[model samples]
Target: MSTHKPLGRFLTAGAVAVAMLATAACSGSTEPSSEVTELTVILANSTFTENLPALAETYKAETGITVNVEAYGNEQLNDTLKVKLNAQSDEFDIFGYQVQDVMREFVRNGWLTDISDYVNNSGDWDWNDFQESARDAVQLDGKVYGVPVATERHIMYYRADLLKEAGIAVPTTIDELEAAAKALHNPDKGFYGIAMRGARVPLVTQYSSFLYSYGGDFQDEAGNSTINSEAAVQAYNTYGRLLHNYGPPGATNMGWVEASAIFAQGNAAFYLDADSQAYTFLDPQKSAVVDQVAYARFPAGPAGSHPYNIVFQTLGINSFSQKKDAAFDFIKWVLNKDNAKLLLGEHTLPVARSSAWQDSSATEKFPAGLVEIVRDTDSNYVGHDRPQLEAVARAREFVGGPAVTAIEGGDEAAVKAAAEQANTEFQALLDTEKR
Candidate 1:
């Protein structure tokens, strides 16, 4: 496993222009030449995408194809790709995507080319090696749109020493979670019950676990908004009460990084987010509760623990790119079994390959039973962290407003009113997209 290199800073407007200039210089001609083709692959700067430059070098050496890898922060990359794809510019041949993040809009706008034929004819690629949930995430209208790069699921992180001292068993249900939190909370000792994501955008991802567990979804089966359902109202109230009454002060302002820091400092008993962040909680250099931390499945609600199992990263070619074949070759090359193993070993994060998870050498890299827990959540919990929609950003914003209000000590009536208003506006957005 190679050490992950620090990602380049976010591309400024001028930086984007400079990157474009570099790509133009490398791209020999608009038409594919038999000699060599320089491919521009833009991806979010993540552990999953961090080693791409090395892989690109390998690809370039094996085949005379130069892959110019450009990495950006998640939100920044999403916005940049959206802008470039909408303009139908040939700035990039391939880009990394999140099925939950932008796939709905990208697919709807015809910005992504259908790779069904490529997937069907790839004899060397074992499609069955992918988990069904992961495979399903990258599909639309029964067509394979992209290859799964990596998968993530929400899991509970808890302070084992604190739980035992408080005489609380591991919480398995929402009621149990609240009771344990109340019992463990001690402001005088500077310990809070749970450090949860409460800020707007970050709140949505963690909140979705609670929402689905309560038998509420962002949209109903027919694709209409259900943000104000009775189940949703109850879920929001519970989610709000847990943090408002028992969480650390200024809980409403905390995102993943902030909340995780609180937990890592041993100030909170429980923190729930993507399981991939376990390394941060267990790393001795970064965490005060290093050896005291433990993992658990997301606590159950009325509907049971339907934690979000999202394929957080995927790779696909641009619909407007002339070098679709070359892009396809790049994707296939990057996702091959050996390369997948290399990424899993280097990143120590979960990849989309089923075989990678089951391999003893890869499993040994994680804490005991942690690998099995991840595999369990990945297979059993079949839900997304966010609503799947073309207007996903707008939808998250609408509902996130109420989430902020509810989590910040608003009364039940106020939360209900906000939910109702958000539901109406969200439905309107969905309706417009439908038309």
Candidate 2:
């Protein structure tokens, strides 16, 4: 989690659209009707949930549908959903989930509805408006299971004051980024060259862009592990060396919350992670480098700056829900173009709508520099951040072993051996799934 703060309680109709979408799942109506008067929704602890109550309030006023929201932490939400869906509970009509982490697992478990036919049949909801990657993120076996809520990518956060004071231009390539980090590194004075997730499990997603930019991937088309490939080894080497050489000590236990705090407190020169955390740095109350910070696209590596452009959050209807049509109606309304613009404009949330990206007025809330960077990176990005598997958590632990070794300052040979070991174990895991 990014340690993100929620929006204001009374934001407006746009903020509550999420609640409407979830509520849509529980109502047992063939079409829009007065019979479906209330809806129950479950959500992970997020910015969306912060506004959920007020959002549901607005929805109720507009459509007379009362939307009840239950917010839980990510782990708890997963566990709760599993328990409830296992009993085929219809307590929640719809819910929000991390697409990459749980979509495949949910689909396989028959926990989500295949809304493809109805979604495609709609005249107003232009499904094509979503990014190709976002659209694909919600699908399994050619069946659409959910609607994407937002698009996310890895972005670089840098100390603008430090770079300028040191007479260094913003780095454009990975090599230059290292050179700049080296120039600015002053750990003896309590400042370091860079910061990033270093803990083995959480590091995988941030490490993904490095893997891709070096022409490596977690797996190949044949579903075999590629984590120990020549390119992969090099990528692991670069990530490990940077953290070991420049990051804070005891970084092995640090996740985004800790690592990002280092940079936010003005203790690091560069930080690389999900763009969703940008707000943590931008909020003056939570940061020391508010004005000193600047945004950049992930610096290009050997292959290029191929950050993961992913649909991090998505809304899905309960497969067991009797009010399937009502749920679809809610989704259609919640994800409509107008509501997308409202989210982008008010909350600075990066949405899945390409048309929304073109709305300059809506994008102005983001830094001028960021708008350009996101626009360029959005067009050139890989679809998944971590290994795309049903067992994502386990896969992250496996693929990240070499990076952990690298971060601990292992020699190239040791790192390579770790990659080899991890790859073998990961392959075994994959093979089991095939059987």
Which residue pairs clash in candidate 2? Answer: 16-55, 24-327, 26-93
Q: Residue 348 in model 2: shift from native, Å?
A: 3.6
Per-model lDDT: 0.79, 0.82
Q: Local error of candidate 2 at 236, Å?
A: 0.1
lDDT score, candidate 1, position 353: 82
Model 2 — TM-score against the truth?
Answer: 0.88
Deviation (Å) of 361 in candidate 2: 3.2
Q: Residue 383 in model 2: shift from native, Å? A: 2.6
Question: Over the stretch 1-435, how does candidate 1's per-residue lDDT look in tens digits?
Answer: 247642222223443232222111112224543434689989898776677887677666556678998999988998999899889888898889878777877888888878877766665466667777788788887888888888878888888888888788999998999999999889899989988989887798888888989999899978999989998888889888899988888887888899999999989988988887888877888899888999888999999888877788889888888777777767776776656666676567578887777777766778765687766745557647777787677778887767888878999999999899989998998899889
Score every model by TM-score. Answer: 0.85, 0.88
Candidate 1, number of clashes: 0
Whose TM-score is greatest here? 2
